[model samples]
Target: VNQLGIGNYLNFKDRLRHKNGKLKYVEGSAHRLDAQNIQVMFNDVTSRVVAEQQIAEERNFVFHSLDVMPGIFYVINHEGRFLRWNRQTEEISGYTAEELRHITSAEMIAPELRAKHKEFVASILSGARWEGEAELCCKDGRRIPYYYVVRHFKWQGEDCVVGMGVDLTERNQAERLALTYLKEMQSLSARILESQEEERRRIARELHDELGQGLTATLLSLKNAEEQMGESPMVAQVKHASSIITILTQQVRALSLNLRPSVLDDLGLVAAFRWYIRERVESAGLRVVLSVDKDLPRLPALQETACFRVLQSAFTNILRHAQAQEAQVSLRQADGNLVLVIHDNGRGFDVKAARQTALAGKSLGLLGMEERVRLVGGVLEITSAPGQGSEVRVVLPMG
Candidate 1:
């Protein structure tokens, strides 16, 4: 046997022949065998070489990909020292390759998160994949949040853990902005609701004290004149005027109550709803079944108002849109929350379409109800479909 090249094996046999009284040596092997045999071995060797070259190229591409990837990539040894890191990792940590070599991977973790970092290392050492969010302490002493994933891997015959991290700065900032915007919106909605209530109360007072009382006085005057005038045509006209005044007074009272119910401000939510269902809903030919918990604790003014108004709007919508004959309203405290559900068996409409319409400003009443619920940090859900019953659920956090 003789070595031909790297990874290439060739078989050779030496034969001796007597040529002039001396032994002559000649080399003969698989390569020097029949032409067909040599061709077959050459082809097999060439195929293997080509395959190996392809594998090498693939590995090179993978390394290049890792280096140029937009995320941070790093390798840490069992001792938690960084063995290697990609360019992004270096840029994000504000450390060079040489500087990283002197520091352990744990050094890059924030001090408060060192315990969690240790746990991750232990888990990786035990062959478990770990993934979580952590703050990375950069070389400039600034901490940045990162979402990271690490797994145990064997690199160059050494047990190491490889990790990848994506920066969460932009995502976290966007989330914070969204939360702030939501809070602002809620505050604006609350203000608008407060203004609306104040206006309603003012109008109700004016109607009761001015319009209502004036109508009563006029009716009394007409009654006196009718009694003094004797049984004549003028007396009949006075009686007719008195009757019209009575109807007008009653109408003014009903309108005032609808605008700002005195019971809602005097009693709590339950009493108000009971009166509303009896006087408004049932009077409008819609049978209402109301269930309320006993001794319901008084909620904050905002929450109570929000809940009442939401129901009022719901009833209005039911009457205006839902052609259902009966409706159900329930209120109770469950799991630290005040839960209200209103269901109507009416010709329902598409809930999604209604919401889109409300967003488009066409359904101002529905939108107002939603805003009221959200102002109190509550959620409103409406379940309805064409030709199906509609259910509105409101959940308000009590604590």
Candidate 2:
């Protein structure tokens, strides 16, 4: 009687779908059955239905996201084996999931970092999320840079750690190339400046010993001739000519000295700078102090010249830019390198402005300083700010 009415009014499949879809299970009909049997049946059916639905959802998420996402997806089991990975991993690594599953995670890490990789994996399984940039090897026998992101998770009823990685090979290579280009530019600039200083010194020498003395002798001869022609109608004109000649000679000698200081090549860098500094201090009406390591023996001629040129540029800048009344120059030896420092208590200029000038056509002074330092493998640094004094430092390896 119950079967006939229910068959016409209700379907068993429909009833089962409604109950199972909503609650993942259905209760057995109450009759005079054993309590243990009913409870056992209920527990088994509910567990299976809930697990099946969860698995379906996870499969849907993985299948839909695998090819669509930009990065590779992966899962590792508690035994440190590759349980599953998305199709995209094959596309990126050139190894199908079937082949990857046979290999250990250690095979993916670069040899240099293999120990570190193992350590990291151990830590992650112990409840740490290990992530950093790592290198990846491609199927084409190429090593590429990649960004690795790994986390702790559960897989197949066991705790595991999984990771996703993105290719950063191109971006990292471009950055490295840019840095290499910058270093090359700086090196070339230094060389150019060093050559320019050598040319300047050569020109200064030609002017001093060759041109200046010749002009001085000519003016002295004119003076004696004019003195003998006194009281003549041309006497006033002769006196004027003599006066002009004397001035011209003086100007030529001064110009020659300014072009290249003879003291620099004659004495070493220290003595040369001391003389130059003294002259500058007197001319600027400012006090100047000099401190040098007395025990520091004479360095290589070329090295000393470079140091002198650095000092020369610093004082030239000081005279032009620094507005302070006192300046200090110190040369010391420390850590097997010669350190030259020039500090001036004068009006300072913007450091960025100076660097920009170095970048521009007018950056000759800074470039020249850098060039001289570079010839002997030295480094020059300038520090200054508005209203603060400027400091110039050069460090040259003694070798």
Candidate 3:
């Protein structure tokens, strides 16, 4: 017999002779053989196998969940090298698993931001959590904005950091657009005040040039007629005075209509629009189409005025810039808001560049339309490209 090691302090292996006279090494030998000890060893091996299977299954589940997570998940070692990362991290950074493992976290930070990020990581390792917005450098030479949350952790008995981050690219873009619009609004406000003064000056000049001269001529003709009463000359002078008075009345009526169309105040939006389109647009030899929802509710006076001004501005732009033969204007209720759309099959321009120019004071008409819509809790969208028709869409909150 010889000693063996098999889950016990002592074991025995003996050479046994079979019935057919063949010799073999048997594990349960009679040199201090204990069945209870052998059974305990068997139980220990079974328990270990079951425990290992459960642990493997748990590890697989955790990895799978991490892979499908929406945000970027990553772990970095004490040396700042990537120890592990989820699929989202690879996608956002534009680096493969093999590439990430070979590079330190500093390489993923923007060049100008490396020094600050290093200190941030150092603070995290010292037990202070780091949470903030920063830009991460991508493999394709792009910088991706992100909001990150990071903290220190013990991974495999070594110091490390586990972090989760959300991409902020879309949010940042929205904020920039809002800021640009704000600047445009400030410029528009200044322009509005100037425009009001200019309009007043124009009205004064028209009255003085047309109405003032006509009235002065009529007064002189009447005075001359009174001096030659009962004479043929007096009859001729009276006839001249009547002619001058008739011409002055027509001029005054035209000016009154130009100042504020009475139809707009008496008959509402639809009636006013119809009258303007026929008198102004059609008379200019341009084809015009107007569509309005039959079931639209009565809107507030301010809202109605805003819509009218925006529409009027759109038409003017089409006439001045677009050389199209046809134009369409439509108004309807959609998704709890009133929507206005103006379209023309005319020469178009780059919308982004045009908007920039307008905001820069080169084109106040476009800026004014946007501002008018915005004041009534609405948005204006202009879409156009060179050689393609332009479309202006506005949405106003109904309430």
Model 1 CA RMSD to the hidden true structure, in angstroms: 8.5
Residue 290 miss distance in model 3 (angstroms): 1.1
| lDDT tens per residue, model 3, 104-212 | 9889887987777667777788899878887888899998898999999888888889998888988999999998999887677746744763574467556756775
Clashing pairs in 3: none
Ranking by lDDT: 1, 3, 2
Per-residue alpha-carbon lDDT of candidate 1 for residues 9-97, written as tens digits (9 for 90 to 100): 46543434456665433434443343233422211243455577799999988889989998899999877888878888888889988
* Tens digit per residue, CA lDDT, model 2, 271-337: 7777777775557776788898987777887798789878878887787768788888899999999
| CA lDDT of every candidate | 0.85, 0.75, 0.77
TM-score of each: 0.78, 0.75, 0.49
lDDT of model number 1: 0.85
Which candidate do you rate higher for lDDT, 2 or 3? Answer: 3
- Per-candidate Cα RMSD to the true structure, in Å, reads 8.5, 6.3, 16.5
Model 1: number of backbone collisions: 0
TM-score of 3: 0.49
